[model samples]
Target: MKWQLAGSLGLLLALALVNVQVDVKGYTRSLATRVLGALTSPTSHFTDLETSETSDDEDAEISDTSETENSDTSETESLETSESEDLETSETESSEMSETEVSESGVYNYEGTEPLDLTQKLMDSANKKEEVRNTAGSEYCLSEDDDPYTGFATMTPYRIASTPLKADDVIPAGCKPVQIWHLIRHGSHGAHRNDYIKFEDELPHLRRRIFRARVHWKGQLCEKDLELIKLWKVSKMMSKTGNLSKEGVEEIAGLASRFKSVFPGLLEKKFSIKRHPGDGNKIAFGTGSQNHQSAVAYISRMYDAYARYVPVGSQPSKTLQFYDYCRNYIEGVLNMDKKLKPYHTFMSGGIMNSVLQSVSERLGFPVTVANVRVMYNACRYYYAWYRNKVSPWCTVFTPKQLKVLEYWEDLRVYHDQGHRFEINSKQACVLGKDLMDQFRNRVENGNTELYAASYFVNPEALVTFITLLGLFNDEEPLNEFYVPKTRMWKTSQFAGFGSNLAIMLSSCVDDSFWVSALLNEKPVQLPGCDSSLGCPWNSFIQYYDYLSDCNFDELCGSFSSQLAQSRHWYASYMNEQWM
Candidate 1:
């Protein structure tokens, strides 16, 4: 019986020691407090570091004495002192915490500090961040890395120099044709890119919490933002559709003006203003996947600027899908014949919308009907409702195309005012005919351009060749016909696919072909053609049609007086008869 009591006492002493160890280690001791009763089940202990089991009142009374004795154990006393020392060391290691920092209630116990449960605080922060990311996830923007695409206006200088061929130029080489001209396409629209956006308080308000999560709160370069930026860059650079940008507008317009400068009255002579020539050869042009169509679209938009008025929501004429089909067919025909492939590929409203939506989505906006329609109409209004959406306006000069066309119209109607070089009524009629002919050529040749060539050839062939051709690559002569003021720098330098093709043709046929020379920058004569012959060669290469269109009796009458009557005298006689 004494041994049993002694064993019980030793067990109590062990329990007391365990309680001390647990306390020193900062572990829970509720189990030790209840040891006078039944022990916690192994399963329960496994389930939790600490667990509770009901103890009888009798057992509880026994435990009270055990607890008192435990408090008095030498080991327990030593553990208490050691624990205090450990706590002091821990506090020293974490001494940066300000007094009253992170309060239990979470409210600042002091002006700028409060205590908090670190784990709970971390979890709360994470949740807030997740919420923010989800909220602003829908906006689209371009990143700094994305390349910018300008308008069609950017392409006009090259178009004027390279003079794309027209569809009528497809006739067999053996055929005796007077002249042929054409326009060609370069290529398709560029893809979209990742972009960045600046947001205002109002926009954020509209987006509400979503915007905050996705954009504002997250800041730039966050993982989510980076993902969006990457998506945009890939989509834009690889986009299969859409017109050129504002720069393209200027490109086409500049080309038109340069065309006028190069082939003065080309349109008038083509239309048969001189009694509508009966045997006039056709002019041709071609389009490609997105280029020519975009050109048309660009032109239409440019013309809209001159409209007296435009309907509020009506979209400006942009490229259509059918235009793209037609352009592709034109390119195919040109390619098959090996005559001169014209570029094809124009945009339609659908294509443009698709492009816009794609870009918007990549940027995170996912273009909606409301936003898309609004943007289309707005662009149309801005472009003047020219409505020719087939051509990609993103290249350049589309605006100038509008201006020059308007100028041509004014010149056609009022020829007596010396609007463009003095000419008699007959000369006026002849010029008008030329304009009509050019227009008809475009219409007859499936709405393409003459002198413009389309092909599956490399776009940079001409430009690259010329750039490497000569010793210095350039030479200069003062006021010389084929000389550029800056000296020769490079050759075969054309801007786009159409421009490159034009350069290729001109290079083959013209003797003074300097790659660096601007095709439209100076007046150059074709090889074997003399200035004394009253024929002038200019920057843009001309096909038979272009020359034929300019061969007017009134305009040429003074060249060889013995062979023709004075155009002025003839005009006077005709006018007198009418009077």
Candidate 2:
């Protein structure tokens, strides 16, 4: 027993030493040698071996040390590996962040003395045979020197200050005038308003009633229209329907409130939305009525807002229509997807491409390789423009649609001047390509102050005016495209609401200043006006100060406060129900 104890203690000592050696060396070769030494260490120790019989306590203590050393070594190795991995990941993320920051800064510095040729070689390898260009319905007036249109001469910025804010100019008095309008149509057929909630409980009886009402008016309403109205009424009552459903009571109340907000005095005086559209209209109880209701809701709220600022001397004669008016509105909303589909690769490239190609090929202009290429470029350019610009379906302006576009633009400018929709004002400015081009030209020619001041007559009012209207300078183009009468120059669509919103929150301002102000839960300050073009207008810090100093924040606060109060208007009425 004594010999066995002594032998075990010796073995433990050797193992402990080997473990310590391996840990210290930290090399594969050293570890192999130590492991081998441990294995080969004495197996037999008998005659004359000066071994001491260790106590059970001493042997146990030595074994514990051996275990502790190995455990420490393993833990240390694991920590080192984990730390290395973390370092690698951190380095990678840091590199990516640096790249992003550089790109956002928009600084391009070439190291070489002579400018190097930079071209996209991969673009050449695109399916040449599949390329197609369609320019049939379009007219191109390229410049003599092949320069792109800049919209410089045609698009000049008008100073907002030049037009005085006359209290009487905002609204046309009694402008009960009927502007060309549109509406959202109702569902095809359905149960009456009161019977919707009780549909499932008494469907058989309700069906009989609906069958009677629909049958009697079948010819007038059309079968599909009747069926749709029935379904809608049911869905609306069940809270399953989406927009413009059969929840007429609640919807009508919202309409009423919106109207009240817009036409403060009209509801009680000469005209009520409910009575004005209902009298003498065939749609008093039908889909026509639904359409009229929508139009009334829009005009009611809109005009009321308009009247707050403008006071016309005389009320304008208003005309009302039912079917056509409603049809146009519904069509615009429905066509949104139709308009945007052509821009998506999945929609335009995948789905519509085959049809377009086949149609073009069959139409005798068999999309030749060159034509295909041009068409592809045109399509690509159009899609890029759509993605980067404004809403695709929100009316575009060209020669044919120019008048309507102008009216909308003028309305936008007028509305913006009144600060009704400040969020949309800047986007409207961008649509004025003519204004941007001229400003950019002036800036490039070293007249930054004059260029910015050119936007308005009084430079002092620039900040407040911009804040009130949400206008910015980005509406101008950086590159030139060609216009027929002029040299090649860049152009801006500066037409749509979405675009107006974007420029109002453009990056030209301080670090997310406009967006922050517009979206802030609390009221912030407005951006301040700049007297000097060199006042670091583009600097984030400078812009932040301007925004903070101008009290624009308070103005936005007022607007948001109004919107919040309107939420109650959307609720169904209990005190006053309109039959």
Candidate 3:
């Protein structure tokens, strides 16, 4: 009876074990089938899963088969191990794919491109170039020394207009240039009176120091440099200060001749030359001085005897000197000294002092801030005088130091004269109104009376006018000027010596008037005007009308009041802080 019971229990146990083995084998087969499907799937969805799961599939299968052939315990253990390993491989692959997918895309990604190391590039470029000689190549030639001040916006000289007006090509298929308003700045001139005065005040002391220090310095003071210092006569050099030089005349004449060449039809004819009528009808040669000189230079080149000159004085034409009467600009100037105090502090700091010291060491002299200023003036004059060639004096400062100096100058120009303050542009409304009036007259009178109108003005006035006119699209609003180091308005582009802004009114076959602007003799599109063919006359009129509504007196008063309020607030803050 005991043997029968034991045999029955053993049979039951064997049956249960067989069932368990079958269940385990079924589970393993199911898992393997799913993994194999994932591996073989064509879709990207299963690619990573397949790659990872399939990697160990052969090994897992081989182990499973070997264990299955041996004993049930080993097969079960091996199956469990393979399952765990497969899961871990899938997880690892998923993590790696997540990171790699970003870089796997076929298209080129500029955002992912590495930034260039500018310093390394500069070093490499310097290494590639041949060594530059210390002296000037020829007697008439300028020194080979790189002008550190070359990148300064104001320091840039007039380049030949890159995009010359191909009148036949640029003008619309059926249009003709009828009336041209050539508003230009005086050509390249000698140093300003202030610059000349500074040079005169500092040069003697600088020369004496150079002579004294020459003994201490060995190779620094070359014979050529010594000769240059000795021969530099401040009196003779300064005689042309504030007056246009021969080069200035040539610059204006060349510009005028270029204009004639571009628009032969408009300039070749006997066009009535109209100027602002404050200086009387006769061409006043010596009255307005530099402006008159510029006008004469243009007239002599373009008209000869064909055109009549209407002399205009500086008094009656608010269009040209609109900022002079602007109370807003005057107040801005008054407050500017306070605003610019930080820049002055920066200029007087260790960085500038170091530059001065370095320059002194190089020249075998003691250079002060005042002396540096004089040197920069001399550099500017010689650069222009030699026809866009760099001067030896420009070598006094390094590129980095010159960049700092340029920013300082830029800050002053921006705050005082440029579009940094809103009032600067508002003062240009008078000029805008004048332009509108002239255009209206031409449209109404059928271009018979006024053929060409020229206004010779200062660079600041031209800048203001162009800013208000929305001629260049590259400028940001006045309010945002303080935020960024990126300057869209460049002095070189807008206010360079002999910079001219020409507005040509063309009559198309459709009887529509089109307007386009020529900046420094290059044709430029008007900002607000849409058509590439040319802006519609009506659109131009609307734009001008919108600008003309800015009442000059109201703006001036508002600006003055705001400045006064700011001053009061500042004073109160200071008093409170003290308390």
Candidate 4:
């Protein structure tokens, strides 16, 4: 036993030297960890000898010396309380996943060289496709070009200050614009009421803990970020929580200005571009105010004067305010357990565990997943709401950590809004039918009743409409249990504040009307109707979910959901649910 002890100590010393001398790809550091385990139980006789089988690199990584890109490891606060065995099992699963997860899922580089995209990375991880996201990375962030605010998923702001869409020039050469229909999400606004309360109550304690843990943060975080973190405080907006913000108003103004510049003749007062499409609800519920105000602000620049009155929220049930009327979607998806299961599953997974651990170490403190979650929220909201200013909280996380959290938000959105049956067919069809109605009046009948229309609503309705149009659906459905390192369903791009879907009906010299579509000002081909000039009038209408199958009252009825589930159109989705 004495001889065994001496040999083990000598081996440990050798391993330590190797660890110190060679910082080779984290593999050497892992080998030392195995040796340390043996020393803790010398009687085991160094049984963990095989390098391939015994390397546990994904262990307690919140220590000062262990925080690195290759030192990716576990440790997390479960979003919910669970038994000890369950927690242990989750940690174990996360470790295994780290070993097998893909090599390059398109990371956000902190060095400020990556294209500045507000949406998180959307890689097709299942089949290894190129990361797909908005490429308009020119001068959005005031200073740091590589800020990871782009990965905040739904929280990312619409890129208003960047490249203009120039909607007029985008129409195919021979086509003349006849009519346009636009649907926009509400612009940026103050944080949620709950967010304010949580920051006031919870973040202060976390803040002090961060200062106490700063000794451990040496070399982990930069000094400038550290100073800002110490000075950080919850905004005084607490006195009036959830109000429309100045930035949101600016976003709206930018939208109005862009709309006018892109299509001066189309958006004239003679057209149907109303004064304000914002909801009349109180600031707490009136998300439309920010962009609506900003858009109103930009009107002076766009035109000599604006035009007519259309009462916001006055459209038919499930047409403008579909969220309020879609009882099945509200009860089943928003209020029930089904839509959030994927988010909850992802929150408790290995990637999140490592994220929690990484964030904690990166900040020089031990933080619960809840703590990191709040910080992340604050970071995103602040970064998005204030374009010219960078949030202190945003400095707490790296691009990798931001990406993981973004994926968490993506998972929630996928289940709730993206590619869901109700969203694809019922919730989405209300607006789909409305837009098609306008198209038919101009093209098929040449009724000439309307020319252009714009409406603003919440992101929920906007994202669902995008799904109905098949703008960003991935070939592989998102699984709650396993995250695809890359996939196409990205909410940040699809439903950011001020994000919109626009369809233009144009008159071609051939005496046939054609339709073209744009998302966030960029022209894109619809799934079946792929054309540069515009798809034929008939082809575009096929995207709509006909009113015959989607009566507002019937689709919202409890009994109708059962019958709707059995429809041939939903057969594959039903099978997928079981699968």
- Where does the lowest 10-residue lDDT sum fall in candidate 2? 451-460
lDDT of 3 by residue, 1-579 (tens): 999999999999999977865765455445543553343223442233234334633223333445335644553455456445554443344323211111222111224444333223333333332122123212211243443346545545565322455675447778888877777877767676556655665555455445434322211444455555544555445356447777778778888788789888876653334433222112222223567778777777766554344333444244465565565576555345453544455556665677677666666556676677777767666665666544546645555556556655555455556655667677878767666767777786664556577778776687777767754334554231232356565565667677778788888899888887777766666766775445778887766676647677776654355543452332343223211
Q: Candidate 2: where is the Cα deviation over 4 Å? A: 1-401, 417-492, 495-544, 550-565, 568-579
Clash count, predicted structure 3: 1
- For model 2 the local lDDT of residue 382 reads 26
Task: Quote each prediction's TM-score.
Answer: 0.28, 0.17, 0.62, 0.65
Question: Is candidate 2 or 3 superior in lDDT?
Answer: 3
| lDDT tens digits, residue span 1-579, model 2 | 999999999999999977855554344233333333333233333111113213223223333456547755774565445334433443344323211111222221234332211111112211121132223312322111133222211111111001222212222232221110111122111222332333333332222233332221111222232233233212223223222233332233343343344434323233365433222211111123333333343334434443233221132111111111222222322123433321222222332344345424322222332233222222222222222221111111122222222222232232222233333222222223333343333333533222111010111122213433343333332111111232111112222111111111112322221111210011122244332111222442344322323222232222335443432221222112111
Alpha-carbon lDDT, every model: 0.30, 0.27, 0.57, 0.57
Deviation (Å) of 389 in candidate 4: 2.1
Candidate 1 Cα errors over 4 Å, as ranges? 1-254, 261-270, 273-287, 291-516, 519-579
Clashing pairs in 4: 118-150, 119-150, 123-486, 123-487, 125-486, 249-294, 252-294, 252-295, 253-294, 253-295
Candidate 1 local lDDT, residue 256: 45
lDDT of 1 by residue, 1-579 (tens): 999999999999999977755553342122222231122122332222111111222223223456446633753455445334433443455435333332333322333444433334333444565566445443322222143222222222242334443322321222212222322333223321111011111111212212222231332223433333222111122223334554444544555444334433232234334433222322122223335444454333323343122121233212111111222221322123312211101112343344445534333444443333222222222232122322211211123223222222222222211121222222223322443455345434534335322121122222322222211222221121121324322222233423422221222123222111223233223333342111222322242233234334334233344322332332342223211
In candidate 3, which residue pairs get closer than 3 Å at backbone N, Cα or C atoms, i.e. clash? 279-313
